[model samples]
Target chain A: MTYCVGLKLDRGLVFASDTRTNAGLDNISTFKKLQVWEAPGDRVITLLSSGNLAITQAVISLLNEQIRSSADTSRTLMTVETMFQAARLIGSAVREVRKIDGEALEANADNFSVTFILGGQIKGEEPRLFQVYSAGNFIEVGEDTPYLQIGEHKYGKPILDRVTRTDMRLGEAAKLVLLSFDSTLRSNLSVGMPMDLLLYNADSFTADRQLRIEKDDPYFQKLSQDWSDALRDSFASMDELEV
Target chain B: MTYCVGLKLDRGLVFASDTRTNAGLDNISTFKKLQVWEAPGDRVITLLSSGNLAITQAVISLLNEQIRSSADTSRTLMTVETMFQAARLIGSAVREVRKIDGEALEANADNFSVTFILGGQIKGEEPRLFQVYSAGNFIEVGEDTPYLQIGEHKYGKPILDRVTRTDMRLGEAAKLVLLSFDSTLRSNLSVGMPMDLLLYNADSFTADRQLRIEKDDPYFQKLSQDWSDALRDSFASMDELEV
Candidate 1:
């Protein structure tokens, strides 16, 4: 299981992913699920994946492979003209992985499920965020819906739903994403940290701030503590059930 | 989809279940998932069901039928010697439902899944809580683990994890459970309002405080407001990424 979130605010895009991956209680491992495609000032694309590790790794490899070949492949995330086209290229990569690995996984009684949140900007285009489904179809985050989450999403959703809107500042949005992740990490064992956080400032067309937040990182630790305290105080202040 | 949580505290037990049921995005109806089988001063047993509504209803019907014929049968929830025996009776009821309806549901590609959280106490026995699975096997909540959740559980898990401990008071535990439900309801549209809340005081041998919280209830409205405000404030106070 995994938890990843992408928020495309008016100021920029914020992406966060947990590093925990588990096949069972015994076979837990850390796998960085965020991949960055940067071509300096030309384009910056970040991919946050959650689902089968093999499938996501394959998708990333295929993207990198295309970037390496650079001959017959006229379409790559770095060369794509628009975020929409880049999303299509990613969808194709996901479909390619499904074509190669779906059947054997089905035979073993496992559903072929993989999903991704692809968000970033091209040199000429504005920052955009998309949630690509297991079927390879995708939806862009609109003005009304500025954030997307995949994997173990529900535990952290209430805070996002109540606190996030389309016009939040980049720093505020980043804090919300981390707080949301913090909520999920506290509750769920499947989602562990040393989180990969990427904050891109719009029109800068570069990865402005990318930080790996560890479990004991002061900011995150404080966020977790303060959030817990706030929740308790909020709960206490509510009118007690008269029954 | 539904959200239900049951907590076993030193003082007693708390059980809460949402009433919304949806077959798809277009079809949603309100149906109570909380059921009580109480002989007042002698015993007070509450059952919260999640998963296939038909199967759960069948199981409840079977239990009720047994209660009607208690004059002939030597065992029922009321006559059960221990809370463990009460769990087995509930499991047996689930298995009886599977025996009747499992195969046909499989023909439609639906899995035979129904889970139950049964809690409370008989006059002579200590209070206990059990999570009865689809296979009719159940596990009792140990002292180390004080709570259990079934059905769309993840979204609301963080608050419960952070707030619940072995030494928590019964009233405090009840408040936290409500906050947990609020978190889940905000995140997932499938789980919704008109929730069933039951809190049993320890050794009371009967349930005296049960609540049906509707969407517009004053206390719930206030709690939801405070939770959102508290979350936003906490997010704002967290330090920004130094990068």
Candidate 2:
């Protein structure tokens, strides 16, 4: 299990993902689930993945391999003309990984589940976010629903549903995603730190604002403690149930 | 889908359940999921159910018939001498319903799924809460986890995980349960009002504080609005992410 969220606000895109992976309770490990692709002034793409780590890593490696080989520059993330095309490239990679591993996984009664949230800006396009399914289909975030979440999403979703908006400032969106992650972390053991956060200012085409929030990072620690205290205070202040 | 929660506090017990039932997106209707069985000063038992409306209703009807027939008093809720016994009786009723419907439902590729949270007091015992599974097995709320939730539980669980405690007051527990319900209501269409709430003071053996919170109920409306506003205010007050 994992918890990753991407918010597409008017000012920019904010992404966060926990680095915890477990194959049963005893086989837990930390592995970064956030991947970034940047081509200086051309494109800046971020991918947050959840589900089978092998499959996600395989798909990501294939994409990176394509970029490294540069045999088909037009089809790679660095040269994709639009975010939609980049998402398609990712979907294709996911399907390719499935074709290679899905059958063996099915035979073992293991799910080949993998999902990704891909968001970024291409040179000539406005910033966009998409939730790419294992089936190689994808859906872009709509104005009404400006965020996409993958993995262990429910515990953190209410806050996002209530507070996220397209017009929210980049800094506020970042804070919102952190709070969402905080909720998930408290309730679920499968999602743990350190967390990877990426804040992309629209049209920047650079991955300069990425941060890794370790378990003891002061800001994350303070934010989580403060949020918990605030919730308790709010709950204490609510009017008593009359009935 | 449904949402029901039970809290066991030092002062008493609190239970809440939403009433909406749906077979699919198009077939939605109102149906009560909270049922109370009391022997006045002898015992007070409340059951909040979710999953397979027909199965839950069947279980409840069987229990009610058992109480009415009086043929085997030992097997009825009114005759149960302890909260544990009451839970077992309810579990038995569940298994009985499964025996009658399980095969037919499975043949149609339907799940005979039903789960329940039962809470109350029987005269000589302390207030108790149990989560009854479809298998007719159950687990009581322990000191460490003073609450149990069933159906669409994750969305509302963070608050309960944060604020609930054995020492919390009945009023605060009531508020927490409502807050939990509020979160579920906002995120899930399948769990909606009107909601039934029951607050039982320890050793009282009577459910005099039961309330039905209708969609337009003034207090519920105000609480929901205030909670949303408070959450937004909290989010606004949080420090901005530096990275």
Candidate 3:
């Protein structure tokens, strides 16, 4: 019941995540799914998560614990010189969470689940993006595939498939992601308001554009309204099947 | 897997279904998913199905048998007085199939699943559409809800949400259906080429337009190509998020 999308474009990376999570319809709550680890000019890493909140929280807390513990942890994400190593650190953290809670979650018939979109710069390397799956394995964003999405992904997939590419501008991509999220939120009840959006400029090593869109945010309201009008206009313009 | 969409517009109805069905990745085949039962100017009932091939085929076979015995059998789709009765007949047919094959399928862990989009006109009634679920119960389309889609539905849902309304022109609605199907076919391997598309004009009690679009069909190819381009163009045209 979440929709989070990360785009790796020529400019840098764009991340968007809806804040709604629910155990059931009546148990709905808003929780920010984007976590930023900023060492300012040195490194800036953002983590966007989906799936079971418990598992994702465990993984994030464990990673933060490592960052706090002596700062000399060999495979720590902040200390890692390359994006690939940061990804490995995330995978290791996921596996560590599984080791502690996987069996208990299975006992309750809740299959241990966690998926993440990890994107940022790590001092020495260029900004990169990766999607880590439930099995703790991961894949990087290639030029041909410039985006990654998790949670209620299908409702938002068509837009991404049709529009995104390597040469896409980060700003345009950010709007597309919001539009995609808007469509999903309209169709699905599980993904709701109060979304977190972040735009990172490659090699800037600083989160340049970040916005928290609440339920009544003016920009999102306009974007959704514009989309509806555009769709209607486009549909009206297409030649009909003569019946 | 399959993708079938049925739209109930003010002027008439539109139904579209993909032809692909797969037992596995390597065992994919083309099987027509749209079934039409028409008695000239009397009734024109089109049923678009998705889910287990065997179960749906069984339902169709039952209806076909009834039609074949129309001379003796009083209950047939073409002879039905109301769209409601027609839905019940289809539901009864579904339950009949489940009565015969539900347990063995369950034993094999194959969920007894099949859903259908039934839309058309019976002489006495206005154009109506219904979505029949696995349990054999069905819900009729209303003015408030103008469209119903089954199977791999999410990939194509955004456009429908944005554009479809009670006041849309039949032509515009039909084009929207095609775009929705195009989006679905692009993203999911289970939904594929050679689609069955039928458009029923109100009060005609017969199909006014129908086309079977194949992979090499010129219009379809053009539509698919144009849609992707239209999407990219829309993305570029939208004002970028100022970051």
Candidate 4:
């Protein structure tokens, strides 16, 4: 299981994902779920994926292979004219991978499943966000719904519903995402630390701020401890229900 | 969809349930999910159920019929000697209902599904709480897990996970449950207002503090608004994550 969130704010976009993956209780591993593609001064695309590791990894590799070979540069994410086209390119990759592996996975009672949150900016377009499903279809974030989440989303959703807004500052939005992750990590064993965080400023055309938060990352530790303390304090201060 | 919670605290037990029931988006209704069976100076048993309304309503009616007939008092919840026996009686009621209606429901592609949280104090035993499944098997709440929730549970779970304790005061516990419900109500359209809340003090043998909070209840309105304000305040106070 995994938890990934992508937010489109007035300033830019923020993406965060946990690294833990488990096949069974006894077989757990760490894998990075955030992938970044950038052509400085031109475009920046970020992808956060969850679900079947093999499918997500295959999709990422396919996209990377296209970028490395520089074959048909016009069709790659780096050269996509808009964030929507980039999402379509990713969706197509998902479908192409499913075509090759879907039947075998079904025969073994495994699902050829993967979901992704794609967000970024092209040189001429505004930063946008999308949630792509296992079926290779996707929905872009709207003005009222400024964020998208996939995998183990319910536990972390209340905080985002309460605190996230289009006008929130980039730093504040980053804080909200980390708090959301903290709630999910505490509630679900399948989601753990060593998180990847990327903050993009609107029209920057580059991911200037990216960090990998490890188990001992001081800021995350402080944020987790402080948020817990703050929640308890808030709870304590509320008046008892009168009945 | 529904949302119901049962908490086992040292002082007694607490149960809260939303009253929304729906067959589809176009077919929604309000039905009480909390039921209490009490024999003053003897026992007080409260049941909170979630799942297919037909199955749950049938189970409740069967139990009520047994109470009305009084032909088998020894086997009824009213005459049960222990809380465990009360849970067993309720479980039997569930299985019996399934025996009668399960096949027809399955033929219609409907699940004869119902789950319950049974909590109360019988004359000779300590207060207890149990979660009964569709198969009529049940598990009791333990010291570590002092709460059980059913239906749309994930959105409201993080708060209970953070604040509930076996030794917490009943007033504080009530506050916690309401906040948990508030979170669920905000995130899910399927779970709505006109909630039922019941608090049972150990050895009381009667539920004297049961309240039905309607949409216009002043206290609930205050609590909901105050909780939202407190949470936003808490979020604002947290230091932004340094990028």
By DockQ, the best candidate is 2
Score every model by TM-score. 0.93, 0.97, 0.96, 0.97
Q: Global lDDT of each model?
A: 0.86, 0.90, 0.86, 0.90
Candidate 2: clashing pairs of residues: none
Which residue runs does candidate 4 get wrong by more than 4 Å?
A71-74
Error of model 3, residue B36, in angstroms: 0.7
Per-candidate iRMS values, in order, are 1.9, 1.0, 1.9, 1.3
* Candidate that beats the other on TM-score, 2 or 3, i.e. the better one: 2
After superposition, candidate 1 runs with Cα above 4 Å error: A103-110, B166-169
- Candidate 3 lDDT, B1-243, residue by residue in tens: 899999988888888999999999999999999999888789899999999999999999998888788476577886779989999999999999999999999999999999999989998788899999999999998878789999999889988877788766676776788889888888899999888889788888777588888789776677677767666665566677776
| Model 1 chain B weakest 10-residue run by lDDT | B234-243
The chain A TM-scores for the candidates, taken one by one, are 0.96, 0.97, 0.96, 0.97
Give residue A106's error in model 3 in angstroms.
Answer: 1.1
Winner by lDDT between candidate 2 and candidate 1: 2
Q: DockQ, per-model, please?
A: 0.61, 0.80, 0.66, 0.76
The total number of steric clashes, by the backbone 3 Å criterion, in model 1 comes to: 2
lDDT of 3: 0.86
For model 1, the DockQ equals 0.61
Which has the higher DockQ value, candidate number 1 or candidate number 4? 4
